[model samples]
Target: MLLERILRFFIVLIMAIVGGTLFELAVPTANAYFTAPLWHEEIAVLGLSPAGLLCILCGTALGGMIGYPLAPFVTGWLRRLSLWVEAQLGKMPTRDVIAGAMGLFIGLIIARLLGDAFFTIPIVGDYIPIVFSIVLGYLGVHIMVRKQQELAEVFDFIPRFFRDMPRVREARVAPQAPAAVRDGQTDRQYKLLDTSVIIDGRIADICETGFLEGTLLIPVFVLEELQHIADSADSLKRVRGRRGLDILQKIRKESRMKVEITEADFEEIAEVDSKLLQLAQEVGGKIITNDFNLNKVAQLRGVSVLNINALSNAVKPVAIPGDLMTVQIVRPGKEHGQGLAYLDDGTMIVVDGGYRCMNEVVSVEVTSALQTAAGRMIFAKLTR
Candidate 1:
């Protein structure tokens, strides 16, 4: 990261010099070119020439000073912007270390081969070679990234191939423990799941979709909560509880990756939310939740969260207003004359005047969808 900042500083410095020169030239000036005329009789300051190394050093220092404060904000925004791209492209360790090295070499070869012919054209001809340099640099970076991923995969395969190798093979095996109290579990590597996500049950699908990459963890407390909810008096809650258990079973049986249910707990913490956040801190794990309040609370407490609801919404097949669908009104909602239903993903469908359609699948046009931290909800009216 320090290296990243230093590189950015130099980049900004070069850009500043070029940009300042262009701005200086764009308007009519006595001298079309930059650099103060050496013929002038201006005296030196403190025995240092104005355009000397001292001046250059001072100029570089000034540029750095200007960039320091702005860099953090810019870099933060860049990080967020890069997230979408990075998630899609994934990180290339080799590319990160040596972006576009090979492409640059090839570009250099091509430029030398092309000689001055590429630059001899009229008007914008001189810029063609420069543009090609940029393109080649980008290609190199992409190639490096691909190489890094391939390298990582190859390394992984080597281990997998020897995983079953006999006698004195493989490193020490840490006995598997429940996720909550698993020995040697680092804070950042292992995220603990709360009861809400499990009972909500969308995470099972999320795991199956490859959206979730890390270990999908469940604390023993969470399992207990599921069992408790499954035993609830309310039929709806009970059904949801049972469904969550079923989902867990399916994840373990069918998912390609791990679904760890740990026995660790926050013995001192009373609330489940507090315990979750504490566990996340202890293990350096990001929480996965569909609950908006929990997501906000986790962030406030400095714990990372992979919000299942947000992920679901971000990846949802964009549904526009006026799109019609058939839904069954499940129950009466909070407001008078309001009714509620649900989509397959458990997204709430609040149909105004749907009270009459209770327990029945009726056709309705989507009037609107409100996405709150708690969950996503759709508002609709009867169409048939």
Candidate 2:
């Protein structure tokens, strides 16, 4: 409401100024053509002709009246157009947006110069600048967006040029600290937390132990996903989602490490995993997740991934061949005469020829332990 009033005031003020100027310009012509005594008569109070003062007053009043009604419609239209532009920009990558803006500025400058050169041409002269500006501005944006990567490379020299400058004098006076060191301490790495790791709830525990260092970076998109899950119709999904949110809150409040929620998101990327990879690259951070597929994909993309499942497996007690251990077979395996059991930390132990021992604890000799991306599996046979 306040904004609308401000807009209305500006509109009225501008119209009144223009109207007064126009009336002032026209009054001389009127006085010249009419050649009346009334036109020539000056007012004693203000040193102006009575007709000129009256015409200016009427013009200002008319302009104010006209502007008053048009303000609301113009304001509403501008608000909607701004919203649309914001939405469109949000969908584009940051690099592309920057490049497009630069291109638009350059295009407009060129258009202005070219437009002025042809300003002397009759009839079409006035429209030429407008047409040129629209066409060039659009071409600039399109071309820059399509070639944003190449443009980024082109601009890469700016940083390199600065970096290559000699700092021998500064070094002699006072040596600069290394990038990794802050106040004589090593700088911690940024550990970006993914949804799966948050939901799994081990990250908070790990953080509490002070094993994990660096800032716990949580992206806004990951938080949104958690909220969506928390609001899910399914009870299990809702619980998991709520748990993730709770874990995040606890980590933020209790954890010693810096906790930051980044608004950085890749709208161009559809998959959350892909976005996570992109974000990792952007921030030079490692992703913390429990997702096997995500870990593999991230590794393939050369992005560092810290998988909770893999970490769990790494920390578990190593079970080698010929090691004797006792296990309870809770269920039969796919193979005949084989039973399956899980270690305390959820490691799968396949008990061969122990089908009859289902629902019972028995001694078993480990045959082998195979390690995979998901986890570790131990193969064993009944000792009895």
Candidate 1, 186-275: lDDT as tens digits? 642565677788777777766777666667777777788789889999999899999899988867754655766666666777888887
How does model 2 score by TM-score? 0.49
- Candidate 1 residues lying further than 4 Å off, grouped into runs, are 1-188, 231-238, 319-384
Candidate 1's displacement at residue 127, Å, is 86
lDDT (0-100) at residue 357 of candidate 1? 75
* Best TM-score among the predictions, by candidate number: 2
Clashes within 3 Å, all models in order: 15, 0
